[model samples]
Target: MNPKSCLNCGHKISDEFCAHCGQKTDTARITLQSLIKSDILGSIWHIEARFFRTLKHVLFGPGRMAMNYISGKRTRYYNLFSLLLILFGFNVLTLHFYLNLNPDEISEGNSNILEFFSKYSKTILFVIIPMLGTNAYFIFKRIKLNIAEHFIIGTVSLLGILIIFLFNDMVSLVGLWKPAAKIFGILDKASFVLFILFPAVTYWNAFKKSYSKPGLLWRVSVLYVLMGIESLAIITVLYRVF
Candidate 1:
């Protein structure tokens, strides 16, 4: 047949998709049915599919996934920051609605800090990204990834950690039933231990191939120590300021 102009970029093409911009050669009019079925639902399904696939890779092989992403094989994975933000939002909602613990009930010294974090959890989460990124950049300098690429791995590790916390929040909902309340209570206490080990475990899994087992362990250890110190400094400054 004859060539037609691509509506998206004015590229001339005769195939089903424009060679220059990839817009479809056959465009449909925007009717209500097409908008709902093709635009809204299609977009939603696309995003959902990518999100779950990305989560599976992140959970099972975060290191390989991050390496793939850094090496430019990124189309298969969801955007790291986007996934982190989505999971963070869900975790926050779970904490607020399902596991709403009172700050006053926490230990005296930590109550204020807990309250502070509860109020500004999103901001705090974003702030922690850079801190984690910096620590990883330094600890894994031998890996040959730059600071920005290190940040990408940091984002993936943080996403895995958040998934752990999200699981804790979800399982905490089991406490609502009187029959499972005691068991969930035990699980709730165990969550503290999970929080401590989860990050190190995530880092270990993500960097296992990059270093020797012993070397990876020490680097992961130092990374957490640095993170703890940085967190303590931030909390101290916050306490003095507000």
Candidate 2:
């Protein structure tokens, strides 16, 4: 084959792509079709590293993923805070559909907790973040992670819980039928177990990823207990004060 002169530069190219300069030999001038197909879709989906790839990394290695993102190598995964906000909206919306609870029912139900959440969603954010993060900070303090990174771990745990909780809600929806309703009582309780277990599992796995050891289970148990206590306390205060 004849060696072609580089179009971008005067360098002679022996291969399809230039060795000195990274331009391809067959590269064409910029065009609308290439721009729309390659640049636009590539930018939107991040075709190099898809969302599910990122989700897997986040799930399997929550601490590492958060550390990579916090340390500025963020392009491989979704933005943790932004993802929490979006998934939170999906979770709340899914709950609304399943419960079929109207605004009045939410307000006038047995307790004002639902109403408080509706009106003060941001407030709940503040409460949950601190409660979860504080517990993690106390438990994981020996590792030398700062408070903000602890919050990232907290968000990862919450995100895991919310994702599985939404799946539970969908399961209950299908189980709402007459025949399925018979088994829903069992599944309903199971869902509650999942609600607790998903976070517990992820939180433990996160710290486990951070510090590899078998004996961290006891510390995570205490952290989970403290998280549950803080969550219940906040809900109780909101219930009475609302």
Candidate 3:
């Protein structure tokens, strides 16, 4: 128990709920232990519940989860972009560490492997930026959220992709590139399925909430694919030139 105040009207409150404005109350003396017990660990559990719920709807029910999130019904579900960012950053850091430690394991035929990796590193930004921009557009159009919210979400998603790529590249340096490539092919197929499923589901719910049609919704998927290919092309050209 701690001193509490109304987050809404700044009224002091003793109970969990504020009476003056009928809003929730927040405790002031939050400790690290309390945070782990309440917010961090709790958020993780809550997010897990929300993730499964969203996944169910995202895979089969269609557009329901996004619609609920946009409607201010957030209680359990993970913040979409935050989840992506955590995963992405973790992947990238792990990959970077692995690559640096075992550079010789990455390639046998190429003495210029380091140069190759360095030269083409910038290509990732080209892919990520366009994807973020496109996702922002789709989020804005579908959810009617402001640009700022979409921008945050888009940034997280792009970070996730970058992490995946970094992981892939790092695996190449571990003498695992050949097998990893095959595994990645499988992942690519899986991602394609999810990519199609999520946007279509979100778009369907967007239609219900915002009354947008499916025809226009296809643009989001197109943009996603196009950005990916364009990024790959940029990398290829960079490799050829240098």
Who wins the lDDT comparison? 1
Question: Tens-digit lDDT track for model 1 on 1-242?
Answer: 77889989998999999999888888768999989988999889988899999999887787778778989998888888888878998998887766355333467787776678787667656766688888888888888778888788777777887887888888777677779989988887787687677667667777787789999989988988898999888877766766
Ranking according to lDDT, highest score first: 1, 2, 3
**What are the RMSDs of all candidates, in order?**
3.1, 5.8, 7.2
lDDT digits (tens) for residues 156-239 of candidate 2: 766666666667767777776768876876877887887677656666655675655655777777877887787788777776
Task: For each candidate in the order shown, give its overall lDDT on alpha carbons.
Answer: 0.80, 0.70, 0.57
- Preferred candidate (lDDT higher): 2 or 3: 2
Name the regions of candidate 3 deviating beyond 4 angstroms: 1-14, 18-67, 79-85, 97-105, 108-146, 149-221, 224-242
Candidates in order, TM-scores: namely 0.82, 0.70, 0.47
Q: Which runs of model 2 end up more than 4 angstroms from their true locations?
A: 1-32, 47-49, 70-72, 101-122, 182-188, 209-214
**Candidate 1 accuracy as TM-score:** 0.82
Q: Candidate 3 residues 198-224, lDDT tens each?
A: 434444444554544565466556655
lDDT of 2 at 145: 74
Rank by TM-score, descending?
1, 2, 3
Query: In candidate 1, residue 108 scores what lDDT?
Result: 75
